[model samples]
Target: MSRVATRPVTLPNGLQLQTGERCVADLGRMVDPTVYKNPEQFDGYRFVRMRGTPGLDAQAHLVSTSPEHIGFGHGKHACPGRFFAGNELKIALAHIIMKYDWQLTPGYKHRWEEYGFGWSSDGMAKLLMKRRDSPEMDIDNF
Candidate 1:
């Protein structure tokens, strides 16, 4: 969602310019072959490897989006509550996985909405989930 504009100037190739709005996309960097190996694949451990890499900052985790991965945006414009949001999401996911049996609806296929800038999932995917326990469940087990 970053907004940028170029300075009014002339180019060496004899192109004229006027100051106007421009789009600065970080999505390209997220899947750049030069920055990430097997960029097309959805590897959850991608950032884990990056964190373990020698000479890299250990504190810079997957949730800490940067120019390389702008899921939460970058720099000063990044999500201010990302850390809290990430932790809450992790806790909720852990609870669901530990206490439920879940699966996607049979023959279900994901559909994404395409746009000029990017794409997003249709958000109508179906899932079947049930509680693992018949009686009272113990939170301590989780």
Candidate 2:
């Protein structure tokens, strides 16, 4: 999120925020290796594992948000539709995985490039997908 500083302020870490300057928060920085192990790599069950930890059960849920997990934002600014969005994504992914096989296009390599608060993958990146012969579960019942 971007905010314009109303007055100069010095952060606890000593970073200066100048008046009228636009400051953008990089959400990705919040989940850095300092906060997560092997953060640079993808792990589908990462949160599932975190949820199993004693104190993290509720905090690790898909729609749960805190200062550490801000996907749906935190506090009063949190998205009201986060719960609906999370369930929709799960249903969509379940159907997609049941009906099709998909993978990155052969020999395609892409990395996220960041410019200010914007990040993008290779513009030409593509995915290869094909219908599956049999779905593990009936998606129609969903």
Candidate 3:
């Protein structure tokens, strides 16, 4: 017999699920233009600007569990590692930015590919990177 995962419930988006059924939140819809300016365009500082937002707090770091940030999972099933993972990501990215110059490979066009309920980076996309001779600040020093 199959295990019943949950009781019937209605999601915020108005979708209903019966007992034992499963569903993944549609995060893409949350970031649509209705919720963000020029949502289709890339803005690296988007989260930076969003940090400390009254409701979002530090979750703008990009991984957290909430009704609107369910990508990190939800409720008791929510990812326990999200906080550590987010900090680890920040440290890694800081090192990359301070120790190297990077950019997309010139003339290489990239596009996101959507499959079913998710999207993936183009397999052919390329990035160019070169280590800096002198770093802006040593990350390990403090």
Top lDDT hit = 2
Off by over 4 Å in 1: 2-24, 56-60, 134-142
For model 1, how many clashes? 0
Model 3, position 82: C-alpha lDDT score: 85
**Candidate number achieving the greatest TM-score relative to the actual structure:** 2
Off by over 4 Å in 2: 3-21, 26-29, 118-120
> Can you write out model 3's per-residue Cα lDDT over 13-121, one digit (the tens) per residue?
7978898886654676556786667876789887788785786565576775565456677688788898788899899999998999999998987899986666677
Listed per model in order, the count of residue pairs whose N, CA or C atoms clash below 3 Å is 0, 0, 0
Lowest-sum lDDT 10-residue window in model 1: 133-142
Q: Which pairs of residues have clashing backbones in candidate 3?
A: none
The TM-score values for the models, in the order shown, are 0.68, 0.77, 0.69
**Per-residue lDDT tens digits of candidate 2, residues 1-142?**
7899999998879999999988765687455787778876678898899888998787878999877777788889889999899999998999999899999988877788875665657666798999988888887975
- The C-alpha RMSD in Å for every predicted model, in order, reads 5.0, 3.6, 4.7
lDDT of 1 by residue, 41-71 (tens): 7788877777878855543574676677788
Write out the backbone clash pairs for model 1.
Answer: none
Better of 2 and 3 by lDDT: 2
